[model samples]
Target: MTRRVLRTLLPAAALVWTAAVGPAAAAVPLPIDAPLCGPAELERLDGLQADLDAKAAAGEAGRAQYWYVDPRACRLSVAVLRGAEDAHTEGFVGAALAASALPAPTSLTEVDEPVDRRIARVPAPAQRGARAAGTLHGGSAIYSGTSGLVYECTSGLNNYRPGTTTTAGHCADAATTWYDARGNRIGAVTDWRYPGTDWAVITPVAGWSLPNDVLGSTVPVARFGKASLGEAVCGRGATSGTRCGSVTAVNVTVNYPDGLVKGLVRSSQSGGEGDSGGPVYDGGTGLGLISGGASSGSPTFFQPLTF
Candidate 1:
């Protein structure tokens, strides 16, 4: 009887479910005409949905705040600012779904404000090791002073170049010089792209090299691209370490206080104040960097690499 129970349990335990959220995952970009709710409306939200998207792209003052499909809730959600609701946004969405003849599991969310998740963040209890580390790896703590916040952040992917790595473009904007957890001088910012697309390329000085490995893991990025729906992903931050969640939406536009940022990804994982520019990955493949999140719902938004 014991042997029989063990045999049954062993097979059940061994039956694991997995998806290769790597290069293949990137290949499958979110459909252009995806429904507002979930996968049920693929290729159907087109034509009539144009006005709705336009409103979402309107940015800070626009009636519609954001639009994305929630796979967990299996619906599309359009978030409007708490006090900024207009009938046109709702009517347009309804008309599009009606024309598509699909059961629209769609709803609108009201958020207090957009989450500006740049590396120039609010201060938190300082974590050790951010003083300096001559050898910086992905997800390692980085110290770069911003105007008001004495913030530390996690490093992003290291480029194929000899001594270069990437972080939040806003991070480069925060300070002229960057330091590592051990207080070692890391290097200088080479180029920065923020607001529109958030990324920065850093060229470390002599004696410092940006390694390919993540700080806490043996695996490093072999490739990078857009994240796919339902793909399992993880984000690494100086504050959060590593948090795993499913890629819930892509091709998302976030209306940040700085400006309207287009082309972001949303996940269920959570990060803290100093988590900006952290690495988001699937297996060994890089996915994105932490952008910001809402005050509620606790979603961690990331900036996907354009390739």
Candidate 2:
């Protein structure tokens, strides 16, 4: 029954988040032309981090947390309940949790924060903008290049050939072209499979060298086991960031805008735009990529990494 459902549904939903509403294509490496953040922006992010630390210190024990970004301000942020006892530590670690099925985000919006209470507001990008780099939504340091049209989320690692790193497929679909901050072509999409599988491996037209800590310090890619229903899993992505959720269903089939792919795992966690190709794993084992999810619901689907 589970296999039957998954075989039918996972592919159509591939471009759900970004395709539903978002920006355009790839560009240069992030952080290069990225303007240094000002004191006010730094303070705001610091406070958010402090608040998360406070919660963790207060013993709020859960693998979930909050994520916020103001594309207008070019600010990306995350808040995790402190002392998160997980062995995974690639930045964007906090985004792995905190997706709520409540009031859903319909469009790509920034988060704003009030002086009091933990209020997150989305900031509008300034007229003169640059790239935004930070830990990935899947717990690694990541740099994103801005193409005026879209934000290209780039990672410094790849699972296919260890040591090969590049950006997400969503970025490719959105980008007209890609380059290094130095204004050099890095690579274009040699191949990409969306709705079917979240993983898109790009063969750089030229050799590309990536930073080691792009997402977080080096954490080896994990291995996976056949998942069981109701299994607990931890995951991270370039866009939606990092999060932890349980397997809501196994072998569930989904329909994406494109063709279909199989071996899906579903979760109740929330993932959003930019997080499309993130990795979902069980502790030390890798599972899949962020396939697609209900923009306003709890069903987060992943295309198994193995497939």
Candidate 3:
């Protein structure tokens, strides 16, 4: 089932959380320029962008690499394999978009990047002295003994429900029950999804509560939203603390070591092991969940909340 469908089946209260203008520690404003498209035009551009993403997900070769609505350029940001850029490809895209009955995006921005790539799950860091905390926050040390994992990972955005929290769904595979740094019982997995998407929700075990905040940062997750192109977003993993970087692309398909995952957000931020399922947010709005990286210090990738 789709994430949206699963969400709708959940109790309305299960999805409750508050996020507003929370924190801007890493947020960067877009450059000054007239918008590429007006309201009506933006609608068409967005619709076309969605169509392009759908095609890419369906394995349509030469479908403009991958795409997302670049609000800053007021265009559809696209990229192609080093050798696949050609008029025929662009023309093919244009022909497909014509059926939308809307003008094309203000422009199609081609980024200089490779089409094929590899990434691995942000591996958990070496064991650290477990220091227990009275309350857990994003970036707090957490571990699960469910899957023979000897490493621990960081916690993620919390308060999905009054008594629940979240993390990478892969973490759930390693943990049926979660524990805090101090070895406190945090909770157990309520639901999780991976591969196509990477995320999980955990209900706090007894004697604990999941709040909507991150450790070492004033920003509290008061809302959930997208991290726009060129926007700076911060992610907190147990080992990396709070790492921040600009988003390079969204709606990206990544070939992870274990499987191919689609619709991930890619950024320049670095994430360490033990940070799986950590939260990536733009100011007060939650953006995505850390999925993996190319290396220990390579560009970081995440699962957009909506994806």
Query: lDDT at 233 for candidate 2?
Result: 70
RMSD of each: 12.1, 21.8, 12.8
| Per-residue alpha-carbon lDDT of candidate 1 for residues 68-107, written as tens digits (9 for 90 to 100) | 5444433344655556545754554444333333243344
Residue ranges of candidate 2 with Cα displaced over 4 Å: 1-146, 151-157, 166-186, 204-219, 222-226, 257-261
lDDT of 3 by residue, 1-307 (tens): 1111011111312221111121211212346453556787677766766565565455553535444565554455444333445665656455443433223322232333432222123333344454443577876777774234355666778775456778887777665787764556677888887666778888875656567888877977898887767798899877777889998767665544344466788888987666778888887888777877644444677878763
Q: Of the candidates shown, which would achieve the greatest TM-score relative to the real structure?
A: 1
Error of 1 at 106 (Å): 5.6
In order of TM-score, best first, we have 1, 3, 2
Best first by lDDT, ranked: 1, 3, 2
For model 2, residues 1-307, the per-residue Cα lDDT tens digits are: 0100011113423211211112222221234335645666645544444444444333341332333332223333232223445533222232222221111111111112101110011222232423232112233322233234434343423534443444444444555344443334445555555433445554444344433222432455554456655678755654455667897555443333233333466777666644555566665565665656655424576656553
Q: Which structure among the candidates has the greatest lDDT?
A: 1
Worst 10 residues of 3 by lDDT: 1-10
